[model samples]
Target: MPEVGVTYFAGTFVRHPLTMAVVHAALRHMRANPGLQEQVNTTAERLVDRLHALLAAEGFPMHIGRFGSLLKPEWTQEPAFGELFYYYLREAGVYAWDARPNYLTTAHGDTELDRIVEGFEYAVGQMKRGGFLDDVRPTAQLVTLASDRTSITVPSTESQREVWLADRFVAGNSLAYNEGLLLTLDGALDEDALRHALQTLLDRHESLRARFSRDGRRLVIDHHLELDLPVHDLSGLGEAERTAALERLCDEEMGRTFDLRRGPLIRFALARLDERRHRLLFIAHHAVCDGWSGAVLLTELGAVYSARVTGRAAELDPAPRYADYVAVERHFLESPVGQAHREYWLKQLHDAPQPPQLPPDRSPGPDPGLSAARVDVPVDAELVTRLRALGSAHGASLVATMLTGFAELFRRCTGQDDLVIGLAAAGQSFHGQGQLVGHCVNLLPLRLRLDTADGFADALAITRTALLDAYDHQGVSFGTLLPELELTPRRQSAAAGERRVQHRRARRRHRPRRSGCRLPHAGAAGRDLRVVHQRGRHRHVDGAGGQLPHRAVQRGAHPRLPGGLPRPAARRLRR
Candidate 1:
């Protein structure tokens, strides 16, 4: 409400510079077509026609969009929006503050308009419910976040530090390290209830609320006062349209990178496939959440959503904060055990052979940049069963057998019996660490030496031993051990610091797209390997960005790439 007798009540009124231009343009259009004026019943009708005509002038929308209210030092903060009345926002209790004019920028459109309209409707509903319409009347405002900043700083966990380094190395590639999860609700969902549940989940996890800022090399994390969790409804979309739109949304979400600082590192959306089906999406920056953290998130969301739909208190247990892991990691790094592990790693890698590169597909590219491509090769279900039995017969594990097969592909490619490939492991082996949200991944370089004379069974044993030994010394992060490893002559010294997350899968190798494993750009040899264990069949795909070795191509039993490159396949898949 405007103050009737207020003195020193500071406020600002901004005039749109283009108001007269539009009025003049409308009048000119009217004059140019006298017939239009003759058709109008009255002067008011003619003016309305002239007004619509003037709206076509270039930059006119932008000029009108600039209208906003400025305030004195006493307000100190920008209200919910540039032009919204401050008193109304205060009456409705919408949180907002800013020093800027909050201009409705040229980019603002239906998204901005809808958000403001929703806030207004919500405020009116509140007024009617509280019998306040007869009292101080509420006015329109826009949905927005509270602007109060929360001061929070956290120590980086060993895993977090590793991720930070990798994040920096591959800077500006958004979605480069994002984790995407798609869930389908096969029943009708209550939109209001689901939004409540999602908000509860966001509030439940501190990591979800966390934002990171780099203070030089050190990473700092802080919280936001209130987060805006907007829910989108696309339930009315036709099945085909919904599918296409959702695919585009997934790609857009997965590919957009996050600023670890200035964070809203996670995002979500919902599409109603029909009255009976709804799909939910969760995309989170890897710095704060990992695969394990996602599992935890789902578990909690399920409880929250269930209780909400049925009108019960969620009553979820307190979640472990990422900070907790940072504290544990700091102590571990300072302990004698940590030092011993580091020493063991250094000694282990002291005389380690350089990583073997897979033979290139073509001669080479003049440019030394990386490119990624994905292909799936079906494995024979029966062959997979036989391979498992073969492992059992040789007293070796199935994974060991698979690695042995992969090594054969390597041997065939390079005509060398000895090679080392990195495999991934979840490093949350300690007590109370299972539920923490943060990076807890470790990459292990498993070296295998197979004699051409030995049977496949014998090679499996060696691979198993290498894998088990690496498991025993899993505390040292791949980042922690990088300085101690020998590198091939072709490898750049600076590139040694490049932390390729080197995950072992994508048949979707059969690794989630957000696994963040870069397909090995063709180099001194094949750079990495991916194994897809699906059904009874196992397909070994190269992260090395090239064609398979000639002999391996000839040796493959089923499916081939377009150019006749052999795809590893088996007949049997097993437990």
Candidate 2:
């Protein structure tokens, strides 16, 4: 038998009444709201008028056309204007297609119109400043969409490539790229509900089901993979026995290595402490997860578990897929935007000085190069608030404020005025990537010069500017950036110069969003939040070693603590 022709079979599928019915309803609604069209047209005209003024002021040969509420913008002479303008608009908080027609609706108000005009101005100004207007840069390139749900294979992201390199670096330790989180639950546990929650999580996040090929050249994601939660019931044992067993389990899980070629990069184990307490442990390969993903996992797991136990449907927004992120990154590297970013980074790090060599606390050893010690200092909530205020006064974030303190201390330690420090970023500043679960993090080099005449406020301002600039151009990955800059990070083979301690601040200022699940605190289930201990690690490794040590400063503690020293001790040292 012969199969139906493509046109004949496809024609029937378009005759569905549901689409027509929706269109009819929309038309009816529009008829009822007779002023909708007028409002949209008015808004569009206002936008066009603003753009025309901006174009005339900037003296650019750009054309703007409008029919009713639909508007189109184009450059008559320069082909790169569209691409450069689109990116600049995006940077100015306006997301638009590459020189495509823009439609305005009744929903758009004056505020949005103002923002659009401002964005246009900013884009034009940037294009002029970048010398793009003077010379035609590369035209924008199109990116392929991974819409085929059957299977996806794309080149690994910069973050994933870095992880792969580190995994190879620490060849003996397979668990070098593992990230784990332990959540202590105090309630009547539900094993069935937990299992369902785990399944839902795995189904929602594609990164958890990701696997790299043996050659480590490509990342392959398997859409169909069933994962079971391994439960270890330690409730039968005595408190002491259960505690010891749990500790051993933590070590084992931490030490367990994943086979990147096989599959199942994430592991979940439930240990029931007793009738009222339980410990949930989740370990995932760093290739598949990051610091931000941990919070996402916890939030979603909590929501699903609560809904399943309570016999209600889980309410979750569809997660942004990792595949989309990979495709976008690939497109970026191949586009003019990527080239611009490369230029910016190169200029920023031109003739950059090497990091000062700090003396290691201990001598060299034959053991593997990655060794670190963790220290926890419990910071008072009041002091945290004060620190935040201090940062605000300097027009910076808490992290930036803390970074200033860290840089100053390092300068004092090494007695170096010029320094380059690696700052960790979540790398999710894109519109759809905030909730993505994957290795999308990027490390940016923060270079600062401190002089004896510089004060605290000067340092803070410099740090804030450097941090903000880094974030603005953080689209390019460090792995890709290093090669472009023609630089190689020194290896830390038990060498003091290769060892540097970076401070990673893990601050949870806000509680989880409103869900049925209760927040777990140290003492009670839902009392006011309290930071039990601020922990940080000190490690000596290469900049791209993939392992970041953390240290925290507890109130009233000695200045020599990890994470950070006490404020008084730091001040004393400064004096």
Candidate 3:
């Protein structure tokens, strides 16, 4: 071969720049962490050992093969079982290619490996029960949809349907679904650059331009939508005057509601604070956005603006379609697994307690015309740190611990041993749903029973168990569960809007400090972990400062100060 002269052609084009860069970065990371390969191999072997035992014990005619960190299923029975296994695996929250090996890496740790084994066990059991091994081919349940440049229409998801029903109950008052975010920038202002960034964001996220059908049965997303950025110049005014004007603008923006069927579910405005400072206000309907999307919108906006300023392309993954999520949810709802989840909820909530009533200053009545009365309860960092430590000691999260305390508060106020607390969860645990910018929050009812003999630790343990059970069965929405239990909507407002109480477990964001953009603090509420209790139709947990401040106002309401409570209790949670 060396003696013979041959034409050698190099295929340099095969290596794309992006691919090469990723490879190089990965190599560098591997070099920096010399034991990464060994760690990954160890995890893979652990998984293999557990899965091998599981398959042998379950008497499945299949085995798993592993070469280093690569794993694949080897079937001893019919080959068609591979396809059947894929569907079952997906239902168990494991996404993989049919009959193809999955590569494990340093990112797969003990928690992930345990989940893999559990998913395999669940998948195998489902296949055996469903008689999938008897017939590899059943009627396909997956729904595939096509869309053009004009619009993408998909059936409404349970979360979206809940919003629609809430809207109907409110008699089309859009404020019940309105939410907003405000960001303060401390640098040179660029109106044109901001405009370009806004347009790019609209183009990137289809949900921002989403519109509902007249009957609220479908979600339609336009492929292209023009940007409308309203800039309010307040730099010419005095500092005090500017502050007043900004407050008024926020109130006005929050007050402006959207017609779900008409158009424009989101609004943007920029206020010029000074030569070097600016504030950005963004408002949208709850149908189009949620707490998680707030972070996504800003992150993408920052990435786009940075790329535009540097004259380079923004590096972002392809936008995942919300319609795809709708299809997947519909498939689940029609499956036997969904029915089992519904049955679990029905049994658990059959004898649930009625909603607790908070003590009111005046008799509870309609106060639609009255302004919101803000209540601020400041929690110290030291107290929060101790509470978190207590939660960790008992294998509980801060959320569960706080929910226990919230239950105690209600018990003290209403003298009810049994309490039901509404918890709002961001239902984004699906394979491709993490990066999605749509409304997928599910409200859960957490029922807790308190005995006078129970200690704090015992109470927390009970709360933790209840919270975990709720999460496992959260696939069924609160809206769907209501009619199943022969119960009317828990929340009813004589006024046209929703009354919500929120209890949030806040933690500081640990990120590298950057100069371009930052969230400005709003007095004590921003700096402390606050608990807000409203005698309204619904109560849930959410971040405090990011939402519109005007919605916090409720007339004829009084804040239960520390001095107002019993002496012994004032020295407990609030302290």
lDDT of 3 by residue, 426-510 (tens): 7666434777888877767666777642667788888899889888777767677766674435533201123344454322221
Model 1 TM-score, all chains together: 0.62
Taking all chains together, the TM-score of candidate 3 against the true structure is 0.63
Candidate 1 — what's its lDDT?
A: 0.52
Name the regions of candidate 1 deviating beyond 4 angstroms.
Answer: 1-149, 171-174, 215-219, 224-238, 363-371, 378-384, 451-453, 486-529, 532-575
Model 2 alpha-carbon drift over 4 Å, by segment? 1-151, 366-368, 488-501, 507-575
Q: For candidate 1, lDDT tens digit of each residue in 310-421?
A: 8899887676666676667667767888787677667766655544444545654544333333344576766566666777887886677666766765566556676656
Worst 10 residues of 2 by lDDT: 521-530
For candidate 2, the lDDT comes to 0.64
Shift in Å, residue 285, candidate 3: 0.5
* TM-score of model 2 (CA atoms): 0.63
* Model 1 lDDT-worst window of ten: 58-67
lDDT of 2 by residue, 471-569 (tens): 777777656756556443552221122443444455342124342222111110110011121322111111222122222122212354223434421
lDDT for model 3: 0.63
